[model samples]
Target: MVKDLVCTLKSARKREICCSRTTRAIIIDEPTPGLKSIFHIIILDQRSGKAEVQYQHDYVGISTCIGFNANPVINFSGVFGTNAFALGTDVAFDTASGNLAKYNAGLSFSTADLIAFLTLNDKFDTLIASYYHTVSPLTSIVVGAELTHSFSTNENTLTIGTQHALDPLTVVKARVNNFGKASALIQHEWRPKSLFTISAEVDTRAIEKSAKVGLALALKS
Candidate 1:
């Protein structure tokens, strides 16, 4: 459970306060046996000029979520089965318009060594699939593709990527897509929870073009 409260001044004399609360209840314990269920609820005050309530539940092999907002929009999503094999759908409806704002569905399968997903999106006009595999303890690879069809155009894309850990503190990653663009990055943890990274990208098809480079550093306290 969590709660947040904020105070703000609307003017020289007017003041406003907003509160938000979140609660979680375990309906069934994991150790209790056959089926386990959990419920979560969230309430938001008028501080944001909107009152909202959200609820989520996970029971047996099914997970469900629902949200209601001040905009009069309702969002719902559910997934069935475990991570090893599951199917899910997400959709949003606008009460004002009485129409579906968005909808998508996906299926996923996972194992100790690999995981894969297939999804239909954009009202079923687009399809995407991805695969990931643990090549070794220190290396892994991923591949993904997307296809979209519309009244005027059809688009397709594919990408492949891999990551390898050089040591406990250093790692490197590289990826390339069918669009002739390639990128690689290396990151090293210089100190506890601190890291430095360098990355570069180039257009394989047009070598004459200038390459892009980037550097980043993060420090944690």
Candidate 2:
């Protein structure tokens, strides 16, 4: 099978030319027995002086993730210098009968002020936990929550979701959150490596800037 390659060019809203960025990603599957990985790299304009690299790997029981950022390329001080390193990992366990449990945590911090930041923000890290229980051959329930806290901000969210298989090729998911948010997703697979998905989210409490709708199509060869 041939994997798809993707490239994207992005820029900031304020200075499009100075901060222009090009990002490339390559994904490989089954290069070896039970191993797959993705390599990603991004480059800011040669004139702008910035770069980053990220790698992701997955295997039978666990996956590893880590990345680094170099903004301004030269400055080694303050928040920009302190927050240059990004690291995290996620792990999941599956039972023979299709039950699943997962845990993930990650943090971004400055290399220079690691000790100071770690001491003060021990409780202000990002954490996620989830569990899925198979109710029937065609249905399952999932419950998950995420907490993010740092000097800059804090957020806590809880989610409950359900998946139902309507038929061999059609599946649907409905979810709700403690923050008065609700969403639904429908997926249909037409054939091998071809998928269609429709998703929408609405804020019941009508919070500002809290609604989203999306449609996506995927084709693989």
Candidate 3:
């Protein structure tokens, strides 16, 4: 795929102008052999002041294949916190993201199970975080005081939007809800590392007033 090929180069599939020294990429909705709904992303150097290309994956999208029963009825008859969706097996994504908020744009599962599971349970990552059209961000996903977030129960719902309140934590379990659209149950994911060193160093003075703008451009589509 073009994203894959672009990721292989110094340039990230995010598609950026030449004036900057940073590049980012994301692994779109392709369930590679051993991979689940994962987005392989790399930041030239945003979080850490050092010049390094950090790679990560988060399970935000996935749908059942023809053979598998999408979103199997998860008889949460087990425990309160137990995930209602069987979520097939945990498939690895290139990145991992979550928060313990009440609702969240959830894992890549099936629409049926997602709603059913939500009815059976509560305490999800802030239900319906954001909506999006594509997986691989053509540009960035971040905004001022707001950062772009992507979520999916599966292919049924893949969204990209900005969230005012941001929490950087991993969500353990969630109960699918019926009120909103259904999504895929994302399994585990694996982040593909770059063979070369992905590095960056953004100076406050260089970005100045545009630092926040640059961040917004760097994360949101």
Candidate 4:
């Protein structure tokens, strides 16, 4: 059977802006022995009255994930009020050398208004491909690249990442980008469906000005 992964944030506050309550509801939760699928709807509303004029924005999104036999997962989600759409799929299988490999492809699209949305003229703006390989029981590596293009501008990036199991309860991941940026994440499994993580990033081009660190604790049911 499928288990709930995590709880969504209910409320957030900023220095000058006050956000309304965020809500999420599960629309579908069909579970099988080796297959699991879930669909959720989320609503977010924010308003600001600190300034002379008030400002507000509302967004609604539906997201879904499907997994079969714990491999070849497919995911697709779109935000309506935000004017964005995304879809992706990943598949894993055993290679001829007895190694495991997974491949992924994803596409994202956006539009200026709901009327012009999903049209072929200016819909898709980004495409990505990711490949992962398990070299050993304790080590795995991933290489991915993405391309973003429009009528007037284009950008591309490539990333190489690896994960190593330090012990039964610890895992480390590091990744490097073509744009002189690198990041590392270390996670410790405190218990079932609970973990602690430390993530950090550094920029080689501007070491002092572009360094960041974060810590997170997560619990899932």
The lDDT leader among the candidates is: 1
Tens-digit lDDT track of model 1 for 20-59: 3433232333434444444433444445433333333342
TM-scores of the candidates in the order shown: 0.73, 0.40, 0.17, 0.43
Candidate 2 local distance difference test against the native: 0.52
Q: Which regions in candidate 3 have their CA more than 4 angstroms from the true location?
A: 1-23, 26-38, 42-221
lDDT of 4: 0.50
Tens digit of lDDT per residue, candidate 4, span 1-221?
Answer: 53333443332221221222332333222233332233323333223211111122233333433333323333443433343655434333443434334444444454331111122122244444444455555443333333233433566666777777888788889888888899999999999989999999999899999999999999997
lDDT of 2 by residue, 162-214 (tens): 77888778888888877789999999998887999999999989856788889
lDDT of 3 at 37: 31
**Ranking according to TM-score, highest score first:** 1, 4, 2, 3
Clashes of each: 0, 2, 54, 0
The digit string of per-residue lDDT tens for model 3 on 10-72 reads: 232233223233444344333344432323223343344322222222323332111113222
How does each model score on lDDT? 0.66, 0.52, 0.26, 0.50
* Model 4 residue 132 lDDT score: 47
Residue 160, model 3: Cα distance from true site in angstroms: 31
